[model samples]
Target chain A: MAIPTGPMDLVYRVLDDQLVDVEGQRCGRADDIEFDGGLGERPLLHAILSGSGTWHRRLPRPLRSVGARVFGTGLVGADVIQVPWDEVDDIGSVIRLKARARDLGLGQGDRRRAETVARLPDS
Target chain B: MKKVLQLALGIIAAIGGFVDIGELVFNAQAGAFFRYRLLWAVVVGVIGIVVFAEMTGRVAAVSGRPVFDTVRMRMGLTVGLVTLIASLVINLITLAAEVGGVAVVLNLLFDLNQSTLILLAVMGLVVIVYFVPFDGIERIFGYMGCALLVYVVAAVHLRPEWHQVAQGVVPSWHPSALYAYFVVGVIGAALVPYEVYFYSSGAIEDSWGVKDLNLNRANAALGFSLGGILSIALIMVSAEVFAPAQIDPGFLGTTALGAQRAFGETGLLLALLGMLFAVGGAAVECAFSGAYTLAQFAGWEWGKYRRPREAPRFTLAWMIFFALAFVVVETGVDPVLLTEYAVIFSVVALPLTYLPVLLMASDRTFMGDHVNGVLGNVIGWAFFVVILVVSLAAIPLMIITQGGSG
Candidate 1:
């Protein structure tokens, strides 16, 4: 269960895999990956990006802006969920995290939607 | 005793749940037009579904990831988004047809206006989703839909030539384009993508894990095969009753009359009641399947297990789907026609929906020791080729046959 090394390893093992929390709940998928360090240096894995904003960037150029606009996010500055690599416990079929999904703020949209529903007058 | 009862009930529910509006109408039409000719197609479709459904269910149970989730992972965002869009369009058409079918049955049972009944059907579905628990939804619709067993009884009672029925199971050549159209339509209706969406998501909702793998296999194999039996019975009933009279059963009422021909007023009542629940269950399946694909792909909170307030986006998706279907049905379009169109178009999306599951199910990295065995691989790849052929031919045949009207 050694952590996968090298860029090729990341492509097959980390990028686009589903994120699972400690309790085995699905958080989201790794739509995009963030890296750090300059050229000639070892590029360290930084964060796993999720959400429609990040996903839209992965679409074709013609579709990227349209997807962002339709999904209610800006193409360049949309809300890309950045989960630090430190939180990742394992990476296989799914990126297993050491924390809960809600604790990691992954359920922010769900919580926000729930708050909106709460404001509506009950029938 | 209790375990036996459970197994029997599951089989019965599968039988009832299997024959939705698409199967009811298309299979009946197939038999009416081609007599016993298209039975081979139904057999092929049933086995194909069994293989794929078991694969999807196994993938869901073992990995705790549903079909759409795997679809996005394996196919990547660009292709996944295209699949999502295609699936959504097909689901909308199907949802409209199913709700419309429910209204058609209700109108037959009662003397109500079709438009009013369509609205009522939408309301009924919304209430069921909002108030009923998931298990309650399954048992209510699943068991009640069993009234369709009357068709099986009617098929047997009509006493068609047994040898002809057996021969239909063996593939026969028909050079007509209309025959090919019905073949594709039957397969498309049999293996609609939404069924996989609903089944895999339902596995997650039911909390199935590795321990439930056997249950998953039994459910897919027994449930779908029995459902196929109900489909074959429908064809036989139509062959016995409609073919001789030269009646083209283009309407929902005409399909039910096959049952009435064999059993009279009591048979008519049972057929209508069965159609009501069967189509209603399909409406729920289509609506939920749409919501599931969108929510899972977008990584939004989902599941009928949570309150509407808890899974607001998921709840909103299905609600919007039902509302849109309501508008479409209210346009006074014929539900039977809508079903035929939906079935044909869905075949085009079949490859996009299923290709991902086949890829992941065979990958040992994902499926681990539970990866598809030799038989699974052979059957899986063989059906993949078959589905690809059907997907390519579906639209052309539709145009050539004018939706099989010849």
Candidate 2:
């Protein structure tokens, strides 16, 4: 997958978009985006952070810590599910990644739950 | 001819699936109190839902995103969190109410114990959800839900003054708080947020794409408009039957009594069957909507199309909702009253749920050639303002009217 190179609005376009792995399987969402630069310099997109805990980055300063303390570790106990910027293949309706969900260490909870659900009759 | 048959089936199913527990009771209650005066509010609601559902369905078809995805993306973490929590709470209560309603209708038909029927209803629903295909669920519920058309038939049989019924189409003001409360209830019940969640997610469940846009439009327009007509028929029947006798059709059974008076046992059976499926359909939709919103917001795999094993967490999510609703309904609260509260409170979540859809639908960058045209934008924003005002007014109106008792 060739990467599309250009400046893009990370806040609006990237964050909160659904994350799909190479097999077109949904893993998670871009809960928070990491940037490489700081201060007055141009910030380059570094990584996409997902999981319930990582999403509070968009909240106000006071509420952020409270939310982090409450649900800092996501449901599957992952502090954060991070996918590096280079793994991204494209960004359209969903953020397409060039790797499998397991390889990216994402969607762990659903996979675990899937095992239990598969034990049921219809599932 | 085949395409037209498909379109006809979709529209008919939509019409059948439109009325739920909230509209049934609320419309009947409104008619009993205000006669045909509240018909215009139902029209307002129909137009509002038509605009929003069409937009959200188009968004799903063209962009492959459902309502919750739009909610989290547009509103961000804080507001999205708020909307999710609020919607989940309301959906749970509504689910409980619908489950309770199904049980109540069953008890009426079979003369069985309510608690046992509640358990049976839940078990049956679990079985249906587990085994039936998504479209099968829609058609079974939607087609059987057409039994609610008996209200329309009963309304005509009662021979209400056509002029008075016509006058109800024009909004009239009453200087009573209870009247204001019923108007809000009528409109709020019509635009329940779960409908859109179920709708957009249903679009994705059916694998709709850009070519399905015409079907989406037909479903939203004709389906909901006809559903609005059913609601109006409920009001007219209530006005003609219960109002003159000073009877409040408060219970789910009492609402059916209106039909029974028109056509005896057959009408009663049809009304009860309609309520069972309509309310039963709502219970299923609420469970799925709860799961869909949570999964989409949290970025988990979700949908019935993926099968229970494939979408495990999504399956677990809806099953949890079902379990929770069972516990709630088992508490012996009045199902009709519970639905009334659900309808009134759901209004508060409308603005948060709808604003993102309107924003996403109109964005040329995201929607590409499918962005909302001038007419869609105008109507969308117009209804947005109406929703905002009603959201602010809902709680106060509930308090002042004592939940529409007086």
Scored by lDDT, the top model is: 2
lDDT of 1 by residue, B201-228 (tens): 8888777789989888888888788788
Pairs of colliding residues, candidate 2: none
lDDT of 2 by residue, B1-406 (tens): 5454344333433443346766777788888888999999989988988898899999999999999999998999889999999999999999998899889999999999999999999999989988988878887777678888999999999999999988989988989889888878878877889888988998898888999999888878877787888889999999999899988877888889999999999999999998888888888889999999999999899889896878899999999999999999999988878888988889999999999999999998789999999988999999999998888889999998788887
Q: Mind giving the per-residue lDDT tens digits that candidate 2 earns over A1-123?
A: 234467667888888899999987888999887789879999887888888877556677888878878758444337687789999998888899999999999898889999999998977
The most accurate candidate by DockQ is: 2
DockQ (C-alpha) of model 2?
0.80
Recovered native contacts, candidate 2: 0.86
For model 2, the stretches where C-alpha displacement exceeds 4 angstroms are: A1-4, A37-42, A73-77, B1-18
Task: Provide the RMSD of all predictions against the true structure, rounded to 1 decimal.
Answer: 2.5, 2.1
How much is B139 displaced in model 2, in angstroms? 0.5
lDDT of 2: 0.86
Candidate 1, residue A61: how far the Cα is off, in Å: 3.4
**Candidate 2: CAPRI quality band:** medium
